[model samples]
Target: MWKITYSIVGYDPVEKEWGVATQSKFLAVGAVVPFAVAGVGAVATQSYANTSYGPEGMEHMSSGKSAQETIDLLTSIDEDRALRQVGMIDGQGNAATYTGEKCYDWAGGITGKHYAVQGNILIAGTVEAMAKTFEETEGTLADRLLASLAAGQQAGGDSRGQQSAALLVVKKAGGYGGFSDRFIDLRVDDHKTPVDELIRIHRIHQLYFSKSKKDRIVPIEEQIAETLDHQLTRLGYKKEDQPLLHTFKDYLHTENFEMRAQEDGFIDLDVLEHMTRS
Candidate 1:
């Protein structure tokens, strides 16, 4: 019954995705707080949390319930409902949140068209900051989610301090190898600056997993080839008789940038920048 945290559950209608981003003084807050399903909804349950609320809430939404109906059903049957706080966004962009009366001081939540922001054991204005940022920020769902989390922390985050954070987003056939719904799932299990660390790791994740735009690909022109050759040599690879493209392909494979690699002699612009930085 010691759960204390702040979180946002959001839906991106343009991408048809649902996600949750949360930070807490509690250890591995990601593991306990965020839950999402592609084509279903997302949930964040905290503050003397009932873990069952996550999966159960999704089940209710999947069974044709709205976000408010799902939350109502969950709180109605729980004997200790007054101790729980939860936020949710259904697939249709309906959002709902509930903060039990008995939750710690400065506890409450706000819901909007496609988001629910909530927290407990926090300084005043945390949820308000989160809601404002989410509404004003423009980018991908992950971008908005992370921005909102940072805003919450800046406004006065968990009174107990921050320890761990997590980001979870799901899309149809978005997982690795296109085999699952886990588009992006990252966690900072324990860190002094968990939100910042999470952001750093997410950048790495995007570089390695995100699809490259066709327009960003450039052919290995004379100057670009020389730069690539020089960089590759510094990494301990000697120029060989094989075509420069072959050598570059080998380097891409070794560095796990194969997803961004192109056939012929073209290279993704971001991948090239990463190579030069390395």
Candidate 2:
């Protein structure tokens, strides 16, 4: 029996996104909890987790079931329903949760308009703190979700302690190079402070992977070339007859900044900042 103490699964109507953030004393709680699919919904199955709840629950939601309907149908069929705990939020912003009668002390979940928060073997305030944070935080869905997780931790997370943490968020074709919906999938499999570790890992991922704002784009100018040349030279680049502009362009591609750069000679200011900052 797994003991995943806390999780939040929610939908963002503005971005048409779904995400789950979870932390636990159990090793690799990320693997046992979050399950989601783009244009479908998000689910976190915990307590004595029934892994099947993920795929099957998503199947029902994708086929037009409301969040409550999906939860009802799925749990009703589980002979061990009383041993399971689940939280779900569907594509249309409907939310529902079920905490089985037989779940451990402090095991329960609460649903808001477009989100659900749940926990087992947690401090009494953990799940409630998560819900409050999600509602009050600003920025993108990912940012809000992370804030909720942090708040949950601040309010005293899993009573047993911490070991692993994970974050998963999905959007249509939002993955690397637009090939998949997995916009973010990060895990701290083992750590003395998994939440803090996961947050640091996420920042690095965002620097390299997240989309750059259009306003940050700047045309290649002589000053820009000089900046690149100065920074690159410090990093052992030699001034060649080859233009530093082309050299910087090559560097951008090498560093996977293709999404924010155009060989036509315009680049995102963040790229330049990245070059100088790094």
Candidate 3:
């Protein structure tokens, strides 16, 4: 009935990003389960699901409220507070989680330094698995958040099974064209294995949108140059007339790897791998 869900809200201090990853036994759970604002916070609202808590919690945190305070304020005025479950992580990485007293059996939550994991109508170890994974997994905020969902599923997730999953992460100037904060917002609205689907799409999303990190950029020479020339010729580019970098740029633009392409005589490692693989 759209009431069974588990989620983790996390903040990555290293990247200054906030994220929410969730899975549920309901259709299109992504639309209602996750929310975040760059330099503000992230929230996951579920259970009987008071949708307003997502925005209201973020709004309160934006005004200098701690994650716990924001949760307190949101649950305070709601007449049906006892039916709601929510987790939040503020910009400073302070986290909090709440499970309403009247929520379904097996509902509860756990919070730590930079993450809050909670669930309703879930198996006993769901939140525990999520918490351990989020703390131990190392990567971008999106990576850790998504791993947490996978771990939760492995530990016996929502009793009724999976239908939808979502992953959302936000950082200042991290979106497409660097004009928005929606760095990664991918969803599996209805799927037999929603978390797996979400992970697959997220890999593609990173390939197409994320910029290359400095450490991963390598000079365009040797085997990389040879490979690029071979791949470009297959695409009908004349490398003799144009420099390898220029020809690679054309290929990057054509393949929608424009965001990860660089002009400093170097190519991102992942982009190079994609070029060779494709």
Candidate 4:
């Protein structure tokens, strides 16, 4: 019966990404918390989490149901409705939330433009802190969601203490290799400092998977080519013991910079930045 506390479910209209982030005193809270579908919506179910709310709720939104309507329809049929807590946001960024009357003290939620923030069995201001962070923090949906969770924890968070945390976001072709909608799904199932661990993992995820911004991308100019040639030589990749773009490309391939450059052609500025930064 471990209850979760301090979670945010939100949408990024610019990126068309839906995300949910949660922290709890429960072990493996990620298993029962955040759920999202690309071009559909995101949901968070806690306080006697009926995991069914995830898939079933997405089905409702997919069928053209608004978040509030979907919540009403689902709660209308559940005999144990009063024992649940949930938040939802539809594809268009409309939002809704609910906290059962029987939820433990310090339980409630806030819904706003493109987002819902909620918690149960938490400190009095935990959910409020989360909402404030989500609104003030600027970045991708994943970045804001994770910041909200961290803020909640700093605001006292679950009175019972922290054990698990999760961040899940979805968008069209956001999954590995453009296969699915699961853009980012990182969980700290059991950790002494779960929120911190979640942040660390998220950074690593973006490093390997996220493309550098289009504006920040430096084209392979004369100076950049020289940097690459020098760095590749220092890294022990050489063609005929001399500078070659092909050798540099091979190094980029090993470092997962395929997105920043074409193996046969020009180099990306990010590749040089990454090499130097490392």
Candidate 5:
């Protein structure tokens, strides 16, 4: 009487490789639902929390197993034949997913060239809808994964109602400083709209946390000094009493510019916008 929905997209531009995987459960499941290895372009998504497949599947992919081969190996190894569902994608774009007969109602998946989407115990006919929406959506692999999550939400995600949602994407040199995973790694443990909130957080990540495209240092030029003076004056620091402004500037330069004039109990920038009219 529960459903879990998830998706992953892994792209490595240098290798020209891409892979996608997804699975779901009733709670804020972690690597249990989906896992990806950056260098290999492989993903393992197991439902009913068949975690053994995660590492084992990666092993197969590392040894050059195609997605289908890895899935077959996992399904074949599970002694309790009717108690597992798994999906995998490999570097070569091959894909596969499995739904054991013993799984709860309305559990299945669809595999595509570069992606495989799956869910279990979802409301009505959500699994097919989720898969169809994922395949139809266009954009970066990350966008397609997000679209899959959106589709799951639209099709009545998690029959028990929303609690948490997560997204994980991987690629080589993706992480900050070229160190770790580069794409979305967001989680909403409990919310009225977990997926929506996840998307908002993802946007925030894109803005400030991803990578600095522009140099952040403000040049100490005359025009910039004038702007700083204007900002200080609007805060009620008169030009004659601007001796305090010199001290503030000294503090700014001395402290690595960590001190902003606005934070010194002066005019708030938000208020400054209104002060222009006043």
Candidate 6:
């Protein structure tokens, strides 16, 4: 008597790959429903949260199992015998998913290059619609995942209604300090419109936290100088000081310029230059 829907989008820059997978249950399901390794693979385990399927599925893929073979092996070994669902995508972008013989009313999945989207106990048409929407949407992997979730909702998602949603994406050197990077990892553990809320947070991440494509960064130039001057004036800095503003190198050489800027709540020239140009 439970219904769940989930989706995941993952990318590995080192391998130049992208993928998606999903499954669900009524509990905080996506936590177990989706698993991903930055440069290895992604998996989704559901239909009563067969959590082992996630890691084990990835293991099979890592060992050179084709996506279909991995799913077949996992299904063959499941103890429940007739209540499980799962999906996977490997570094090569091969994809596969499964729904057991005795799952609830409406449950199944579809796989594709770079992605898979699925749901269980959903309305008759939602799962495939989600997969189709994901396939058709444009933009980053994150955008396509969100679109798929939205489409599922539009087509009557989770027969029981919404509670939680999550997203995870990873790439090599994608984390902070390049020590650990998750391109996108956000969740709404419980919410009325979890998918929409997740989308809002994703937009915020793209605007501020996400690293821009290398081509998107505009070099600091004279146009930015004027913009910085205007911004400083609006923030109550003396307009006269605009011209006297030194380059970042000059500020670094000054004894307390950095501290002064911090105290005044003004961005350093280097940051201002980047922001204004961007």
Identify the runs in model 2 with alpha carbons over 4 angstroms from their true place. Answer: 219-227, 236-242, 263-266
- The TM-score values for the models, in the order shown, are 0.95, 0.88, 0.87, 0.84, 0.70, 0.74
lDDT of 1 by residue, 95-192 (tens): 99999999998999999879999999999999999999999999999999999999999999899899999999999999999999999999999999
Cα RMSD of all models vs. native, in order, equals: 1.5, 2.4, 2.7, 3.0, 7.2, 6.4
Per-model CA lDDT versus the true structure: 0.92, 0.86, 0.89, 0.86, 0.60, 0.64
Q: What does candidate 4 score in Cα RMSD to the true structure?
A: 3.0
Model 3 C-alpha lDDT per residue in residues 84-133, reported as the tens digit of each score: 99999998999999988999989999999899999998988899999999
Clashing pairs in 3: none
Residue-wise C-alpha lDDT for candidate 5, range 51-118, written one tens digit per residue: 76777878888899887888788788778647676667776666777778887766677776566766
Instruction: Write down the lDDT that model 5 would get.
Output: 0.60
Backbone clashes for every candidate come to: 0, 0, 0, 0, 4, 3
Which regions of candidate 5 deviate over 4 angstroms? 1-25, 211-278
Pull out the clashing pairs in model 2. Answer: none
Give the per-residue lDDT digits (tens) of candidate 2, residues 113-184. 789998887888888999999999888788888888899899989888899999999999999888999989
Model 6, which residues run further than 4 Å from truth? Answer: 1-3, 8-27, 212-278
Please, what are the lDDT tens digits per residue for candidate 4 over residues 1-278?
Answer: 74766688999999999999999999988889888998999999999888889999999999999999998988889898898999999999999999989998888999988999888888888888888888999988889998999999999999999999999999999898999889999999999999999998998688778776666655566777778777776777766855476687678778776666653545555566667866
Q: Name the candidate, 3 or 6, with the larger TM-score value.
A: 3
Q: Between prediction 1 and prediction 3, which has the larger lDDT?
A: 1
Better of 4 and 6 by TM-score: 4
Number of backbone clashes in candidate 4: 0
Clashing pairs in 4: none
Indicate whether candidate 1 or candidate 6 has the larger TM-score: 1
The TM-score of predicted model 4 comes to 0.84
Best candidate (score: TM-score): 1
Regarding lDDT, does 3 or 4 come out ahead?
3
